[model samples]
Target: MSPQTKSKQRVRDHGEVFTAEREVKAMCDLVKDECDRIDSRFLEPACGNGNFLAEILTRKLATVKKLYKSNPYDYERYAVLAVTSIYGVEILADNAEECRKRLFALWDKEYTAVCKKSANDETREAVRYILSKNILCGNALTLMCVDENQKDTDKPIVFPEWSLLGTKLKRRDFRLDVMLKANDKPKNGQPSLFDVPEEIRKYLSINPVTKEFMAEPICEYPPVHYRKVQENG
Candidate 1:
């Protein structure tokens, strides 16, 4: 089992404690169906070394393997999709970095075995890039990116929404603060999208379907091949 505590200072400073593997598995089992769904999104607010996220990725990839193992193309894309759906915000830079590497290792192990000879470097780099963005080094409480010392920075934590379109992927970046408030009901006297007269941000407008504030992307990029997502940078 992975060590639960890295050091007394981290625990005291950041409340850094990794959940045990057994507990992680047990907790994940409670949401077995979601974990097994390839595109279902899971965000870990206090993700440390990714004990829970790792298990969820394992379950999701297992489903991907079972369904697409015969088709390398489908297997590769779905595996990447699975990685995209898992997100994390860890306060400690080293822990966040470790979490990213650990999750990628877990992903690559399964990916290589299933896709075999068809697996390519571009795809591996794409997964690495996805993990780099998905597992952010930030303060979940402050909803801001953290410095090396784990102190909050001015930059708000932004998460990229990755949507697969056939062989391509579309990405939209949204602020964590905005995302958290997106579902809040419009204040009794406040104007919703329909009530606004002047030009307004689409994301700030009420989502007609959900009757909640829309979580608009701060920045959007055109679709790119899943393997070429890094090209957007």
Candidate 2:
């Protein structure tokens, strides 16, 4: 692993400190089952260089290999699903890019070794596209995308909810701020966010079963074959 701090200045400026590998392992062990599930979703709000996410992906891939090693088609699909389940937000653009490259390298190495003759470029590119969407350069606390200088942008951070339906993948984009707001209720005597003006309230949806207010996706794409998401989704 790289040193915990790139420089003293970075530490002071951004409170950046990379977690050691041993500690990352121990913390993940606390939710070991989730880490092993290929489609289980995980988000690291302050994922500096992806120390924790890397380990979780490694474990999920291992489980995929164990179950699908004999069948290349199954292995490729599940491995891509594993990659799609991981997400992160890093305040620094450089760190966010590094985290994405690091994850892709780790996944590609295992994929190449296992699928060997069966691996194809289309599936690999699909994984790349998923990572591009799943990881973001942003401030998790403010839930806004960040600029190169780490200033919050006027644009709110948006993330796609990716789900697989057999060989097809479905996507829905949600604003981070709206998602957080939907998860909580207004405190006593406070106004409900859904009670806003009609223009903004249009973004909220109701769960038919639970009868609860939920954040409506800003946009959604029809399910497309996993290999064609980047091109057609």
lDDT scores of the candidates, listed in order: 0.89, 0.87
Candidate 2 displacement at residue 209 in angstroms: 4.5
Residue 104 error, candidate 1, Å: 0.6
TM values, all candidates: 0.92, 0.92
| RMSD values, in order shown | 3.2, 2.4
lDDT of 2 by residue, 15-85 (tens): 89899899999999999999999999998999999899899999999999999999998899889889989
Q: List the candidate 1 regions with Cα displacement exceeding 4 Å.
A: 187-203, 208-210
Q: Write the per-residue lDDT of candidate 1 for residues 1-233, one digit (tens) a residue.
A: 23889788777888877788889999999999999999999999999988999999999999999999999999999999999999999988888998999999999999899889999999999999999999999988889999998889989898999999999999999888777766666778353665532323444756566566777788999999999999996
Return the TM-score for candidate 1, rounded to 2 decimals: 0.92
